[model samples]
Target: MNNVKVNVAQVRYREGESVCFDLVEDFSSFDLGTEILSFQAPVHVQLQVNNTSKVLLVHGKIDTKLNATCGLCLETFVYPLSLSFQDEWIFRAQATDDLLETALILDKDEIEINERIFEQIVLALPMKFICSAECQGLCPTCGANRNLAPCHCGENDIDPRLAALAKWQSKD
Candidate 1:
């Protein structure tokens, strides 16, 4: 019944059986956080499910575009995101006591992967968003974006810790 749920009975549950699925839909259901301005298109997911009798191995990649603000210049730009993940889903009856303590439980007939996919997307986001590697950032004195234009601030603004050394050098 879940959005991303897949019925295990529908797949071939053999030793090495594999199934592939493509998910293309809007991502409005999941909270993408404030850093993401908007989703440009549907999130495209390519997944391969492998059955190992005792467990199901899910491996896939998620692709999407997001509007993000540059941390340095605070400019909004379109950002492309591609994330890959691999995980195991074990049946509750087959899981050992130790695995039951730490592993996720698979339902009797279905496996829900909505939360897992959302979590992976969240983890894949960059800690710092920059429009480009050459971004010059804002000037500290006048709050001017150095990437756009050069500021008129003089270079005489030296660190206070080096002021004594500057005076000594001037005397020489």
Candidate 2:
């Protein structure tokens, strides 16, 4: 039951408002599983909430950076996180959260806070995070990061389909 609900009574807030906080995903203390590519600068975010046309909007802003790993090279790099997101949190709706063992749903009178948004941020962590513009990435043959150095496995094996051409002489 690793659930963190912002008990409205504790925080001085209204239904339509925003809040800010310092965040930290402890690399040394937490086991985020194998899927969590990487993290940089911990994470700090500013969240804004507003009600319009009977829909509660949840917006987010990046107060810091998140260093993520490149999908190709598996090397970590700084990734700017400036989220100007707007999503409708229905008075009663379900959303996924990596931190939540169960789905998060909002009530009619609740301020509409959900850790699922954090999950969305995690999901937004680039599918292919490159360390730099000139990153060479890892060698496919030998499983070595090319950004570090060149590998001897540069020679690729010829496809068997093309091997038939080896015996075919030019017909003059």
TM-score of each: 0.81, 0.52
lDDT of 2 by residue, 89-108 (tens): 44343333531343234564
Whole-model lDDT values for every prediction: 0.77, 0.53
Off by over 4 Å in 2: 1-33, 36-38, 53-55, 89-116, 132-134, 156-163, 170-172
The residue-by-residue lDDT of candidate 1 on 58-142, one tens digit each, is 7889999877889999888888999998877778878888767755578676666777777777799888889999998888889
Candidate 2 least-lDDT 10 residues: 1-10
lDDT of 2 at 151: 88
C-alpha lDDT (0 to 100) for residue 114 of candidate 2: 36
Candidate 1, run of 10 with poorest lDDT: 28-37
Residue 66 in model 1: lDDT: 78
Q: Which residue pairs collide, candidate 2?
A: 40-67
